[model samples]
Target: MSLDIGDALRSGIDDLTGEDGLLVGSVFLLYSLGSLVADESLSAELLTLVFESGAYTAEQRAMVDSFGGSPFALGVGLPAAVVLVVLVALAGELVRYWAIRSFAGPAETETDAFGDRAVMAVGLGGAVALTTLLFQSVLPVVGQLGGVATTLVGSIVGPLAGLVLLTVFVYLRQEIALNDGGYGETVRNSFARFMDDPASIVILLVVLGLFGLVGGLPSLVAGLAGGDAAVAGLPVTVLTRLLSTVLGAVFQTLGIAVVTDAYLQVRTSARESAA
Candidate 1:
């Protein structure tokens, strides 16, 4: 498959320009909200509650507390995290949509919502679930290896897990397209070609890495500033989590968009090759 970096970037821009901003915004809002609950800042409280309520033993709580994240993140912090995520997603989508549109034309209005959501759920959800599972299984070994060793293992394992997840995601997405009156086998075939063409996969990963970098910079900067400071109460903890969620949701969307577009591009390319 031929690589066209310029085209991809331009297409992502066009896709965003053509999107129903209101719809996208609404989705972002919901995503941001959900993310708030998922973030570490807010989740700590929930986890604490669970631990305090006897859901887990004191030893488990100790392990969790030992991880040493921001304790100041509570209620407000959580919302900030949510907004951060939403904003990042907004930025990522702005570029991604344009890039996609440059190549694919306007996304189909009739199928847009369902198609997007389906891809998001399957692609993102699958990756997260798989990664979490793998991470959990590896934790024992990681702990035995110590912090440095665990971190090293995580560095290698995370990307490998992503590759596996993407492969599974492509297959499922193709099935959706084919049977759901969606995009059809185009995605499936393209994914196969991308897999065969290592360069294309490398380019895709590079693009995704760029996206991650863009999405991560703000939070990293915040953490550096004062985000790491500890808060005194549950309310603050909840806020912090909310903020983390919003930020996570936004960045997560970027990831979701990249996966979706790549799958679609692969499908399109495969069809052209077949033709």
Candidate 2:
């Protein structure tokens, strides 16, 4: 009943190159671009408002003011920017439902279950967002306690907590897509799956993490460079960001494929053993 990592990876690669995979990749690309625009615009406006209000520390204010204006603007206020970001996120979630079902290999007769699956996807997304928010909300309180031990603990625990949440999320997606389970059942099943084969999950996560790091290099370099150079009168930073966005889309799509394949392998093994 153990996972065959090599077979799963090969199957995943096949899934990623399929026609539906291209659709998933395209949706991810649009989502990435939309999020970048909305997030940058919102961040600039928030910083400007904070700076003008002098609510931040003097040092923080000075650094932000040095930008000479907003780092990015879309002529939209914070409220509008928030709405745009939410819309983009919702769109992505809807498309992701289809992608997940496609990966799960539903029968043609099950096409009518789209509404149910879509609702489950949205519910799952909301639950994850709330969980993440709650987790992050604890960090400031820990920081305010103000001790080196607390800081060290937070640094170590934070990444581990994030990784656990991510693992749960990945398996939960597959469970919801492939099984007729509600939120609670899916959550429990995902946890059980992790407990049953933690090593396989860890290996899959490490592989994905390496791929993500490679995909993110362009963006990291551009950020470190501070975007000082221009090529053909276009900023190198812009070009790098564009390249990073594309790579991110590809990486995300591949991750989804690989995880889905791995989940199916585990599920099939369990079923055969039961039989």
lDDT of candidate 2 over 1-275, digit per residue (tens): 47877877777778778888887888889888886777667656655554555446798566544433333358598789757756665666666667777766765213457787777767786566445533443342243244567656655666567657877666776776667766788788777777667788788878888988887787667655555655687666677777877998888788888887777777766667789
C-alpha root-mean-square deviation, each candidate: 8.5, 4.2
TM-score of each: 0.53, 0.79
The collision pairs in model 2 are: none
Supply every candidate's count of residue pairs whose N, Cα or C atoms clash at under 3 angstroms: 57, 0
**lDDT per model vs. reference:** 0.46, 0.68
lDDT of 1: 0.46
lDDT of 1 by residue, 104-161 (tens): 3345222344344355435433444445534543333233334557556665775566
Compute the lDDT of residue 103 as modeled in candidate 1: 29
